[model samples]
Target: MMILRLALAAVISAYAAAQPASTSSSLVTYIFGDSLTEVGNNNYLQYSLARADFPYYGIDFSGGKTTGRFTNGRTIGDIISTKLGIPSPPPYLSLSQNDDAYLSGINYASGGAGILNETGIYFIQRLTFDDQINCFKKTKEVIRAKIGDRAASKHVNDAMYFIGLGSNDYVNNFLQPFMADGQQYTHDEFVELLSSTLHNQLTTIYKLGARKGLR
Candidate 1:
């Protein structure tokens, strides 16, 4: 499964690489997902129950210090960005709005977050798909302020947006006997809800200026 996921991520990176040079250089990368794509957004959440800032989490990373990535080293997001010849965007929570790094887009994923806001409720704190998208909106505002509306619009449209989500909604929410979703709806109904919710969220991103996306 890990190998498969890496292969798919590579496809997106390759597509980005194949983009015309004029647009490629201006392309920023944004990531959203659960542990598989999470870098360090959860580390900055004061009360976040899902965290990876401890020993063994990043033993393979440089300096052997944990950076909130769930993997032993870099997450798929890190690998994809490095392949694209750009630094992986930093966690949105880790940067001040005025920081120059804000121009490079942001990673808004949380380790336990899911498409449905209630999916990770037991974790006490996780950024749902809604929360991550909201952060992106704020990110756009910051970029607009720095480069003006027209330029920012163009930059955002040129950016690469990646999302790895949904599995958790089933693994951690719908199938969890302790959760009400399982009791409230049949499996088919739940699946439909998940699909529609994801479609709507992706549409929201498209309307917000994201033109190239991979999931």
Candidate 2:
């Protein structure tokens, strides 16, 4: 009887220790980007021309509430989060009003945002990579406040960061300039510019402590 009680206590202690390990390994994914990844930040920007707060966008999502996700159903981030056994992140703007459920994940993506500082043609608000980084920094602070330093560090290190932005640069910046001048940059030159800008943005994130990142 004594031996059985001792073994039971050992098993209970092992289970308790394993709980944190399991959570640490549970893979937290943070998605950052433009309209493609903008789950709903545009909705909060009242004067911004990049608002998607309407139907048909979330027709396939739960309850069919247009959460400002640009895709007809789910963006790549949504699909990836579903695969990772977690819910898709909420927009950074929405974080203020929503409950703690969304504090764990954050989306800093905004419509018309680009890698270059001046890449968008929209006369309204546009988010450059620099602006996105600022939002990300703010979100990190909130995460730290909510989850503490250790869990926040684990989340940043283990989370998969997805960055998808560059399409707008081509469509809104390069194409328009080329059409106006009747002259176009060589494909290599365009690629070089995009690559250089992307590299700088990525380096900023790395310096900010993003360990697992994807672009």
Best by lDDT: 1
lDDT tens per residue, model 2, 85-161: 56778777776732574346677888888777766646377567788788777766767787897876666766667
Q: Largest TM-score belongs to which candidate?
A: 1
Off by over 4 Å in 2: 1-25, 97-103, 146-151, 178-187
TM-score of predicted structure 1? 0.92
Q: State the C-alpha lDDT per candidate.
A: 0.86, 0.69
Q: Compute the lDDT of residue 18 as modeled in candidate 2.
A: 51
lDDT of 1 by residue, 149-176 (tens): 9999998898888888777787889889
TM-score of each: 0.92, 0.76
Q: How well does candidate 1 score on lDDT at residue 21?
A: 60
